[model samples]
Target: MRKQHIKSHPVASLYVENQSWLRGWLYRKVGCTHLAADLVQDTFERLLKRESYGDVEKSGAYLKTTARNLVIDHWRRKALEAAYMEALHIQGEAYHPSPEEQHMHLDLLNRIDQVVQRLPVQTRQVFLRVQLEGWGYAKVAESLGISVSTVKRHLKAALLECCFYCE
Candidate 1:
């Protein structure tokens, strides 16, 4: 009966039995209750999705290392996000804009969208290719089977129209 039960049961039960030890191990290493809880949850989540492990004897060791790596990754991502937010905050402080300036920028972007919508099909295609898709003039010209000069002309027309409407 014991053998049959072990065979029928999921490894998830083993994880549940070890959860407290896993949390304690993680907390000791990470020194943060929240971080340890998060890592413990993620470790189990990965275990659930993983395929059959031939050598189940190493589960605990593997889980511990995986939890540590996850903690490292979390710290790295947090640092990157912090740096990005700091940069954005500094830029915001450096370039203070009046409410009118903000409104004007939004208005110009809307008008540019309207102008692009009004353009001829070919002109709109060329503009979207170069500006929105980040394609080079040569690439756009080759793809559309048009001369590079024609590509340039369409781009100029689109820009002029957008600027005229924006102002």
Candidate 2:
């Protein structure tokens, strides 16, 4: 239901009755009063939107289950964000590109991608393996079952096309 409807909701009465208990339970689970308070609020907000709590025989159990799920979701989101930040930290100076530099870099990458897409399939594969993936020409040729000279020819064509855009 909407915010206005929440004031008159049966869940509102439930919230008023059990809010302190719920918050204390959350605090014990999460070990932080501030986060527990926030989760209690979130739990009540979720309860307000439920179509039926009338069938819920044990309201406290239902509230605890919902709050527990919220806590789990909160932890998962925190872990994922931490992993992303850690990856950025590992990139060091590249993590914080200036807006203009970022724009230019993205434009260059897009142009390069477009050029690669226009190449013949074998040429694109050879170029990606040798240039983008840092594979040796000999290794690429071996992997593709082509002669080294054919690999060089495709890479030269790809580089020339890339240079045409660069100029």
Candidate 3:
């Protein structure tokens, strides 16, 4: 059996020696174990492909500074996502009106109905025909066989009565 000797690359040796220290430093600085591990792995991966680092004088400082910038970017993205979620939560809350608000709206409509019922027959008819049925003044006047002025007078009186009763 023949034994073969392999040469170790200087860059790979330095990476192995410093990885543990780098991981610990990154965890303390970023306050996140998982992110620290990820950044350290990414830095080494980038070192393999990066051609412009050009025999860096202080590789440790370069790694630490790069890790810090990565952490800052991560925090910025987290903040933006948090704000987006808060906006969505507010919009979802608004999409469904509160039960109390729905009840209040129903109560107001019922009160209006009761007030219209209490009016005189002609006034109730005029109010319902014009307001509830959405008929124009001329159409209501023709249907009731009254002049437009008479229809307007009835509507005004009905509105006043409604306001008085509602209060």
Candidate 4:
């Protein structure tokens, strides 16, 4: 088979220009060289998939924003995984899942996490408060300084997003 030459994307230039700076910023935020490198790669990958880079004048700002979101996502996933592991630990040895089942559960959790990350911030917070933390809608609204109806709306949006992910 002949190897095909792949054209470099426009984002390639952006990556070449900003990779080091972005990685350094991420390293300062995350305090891990390896994780920062991974996040830099993810940031560019996300940029490549975006429909438009928006204003060329603000490309650097866009890149930084994307990288910052990636860092937040990394932390959120880490926290979710930690919570999952803690739950499993609390279940004790009596609740052993087969390896395959465990893998499936983790995969499902990752899918759920991806869906949650795509949600609007307020909706995500409302969903997490009501579902994960077992808070009532009223409590979430009170804490978030929103009305109960607004909380319900956010939860509905979040659930719809989850349903879309499952499909």
- Name the best candidate (by TM-score): 4
lDDT of 2 by residue, 95-155 (tens): 7767677557556665676688789999999999998689998999999999999999999
Q: Candidate 4: which stretches are off by over 4 Å?
A: 1-9, 54-58, 114-130, 133-157
At residue 11, what lDDT does model 1 achieve?
60
* Candidate 1: C-alpha RMSD after superposition: 13.8
lDDT of 4 by residue, 1-167 (tens): 22222225566667778899989999999999999999898888887788876673347888788889888877887887788778889999979788788778777788888998789899999999999999998899999999999999999999998988876
lDDT (10s digit) by residue, model 1, range 42-157: 98777667787545434687777778877776765565556645655689877766767755654555556668878999899999999989999999999999999999999999
- Measured against the true structure, the TM-scores of the candidates, in listed sequence, are 0.48, 0.52, 0.46, 0.70
On the 0 to 100 scale, the lDDT of residue 91 in model 2 is 94
lDDT of 3 by residue, 8-91 (tens): 544466577778998998899788899889989887766666765555434677777766776765665566556645655688
Worst 10 residues of 1 by lDDT: 76-85
lDDT of 4 at 45: 82
Top model number, lDDT: 4
Root-mean-square deviation per candidate: 13.8, 13.0, 25.5, 4.1
Lowest-sum lDDT 10-residue window in model 2: 76-85
Screening candidate 1 with a backbone cut-off below 3 angstroms (N, C-alpha, C), the clashing residue pairs are none
True-structure Cα RMSD, model 4:
4.1
Q: Clash number for every model?
A: 0, 0, 0, 0
Evaluate model 3: give its lDDT.
0.74
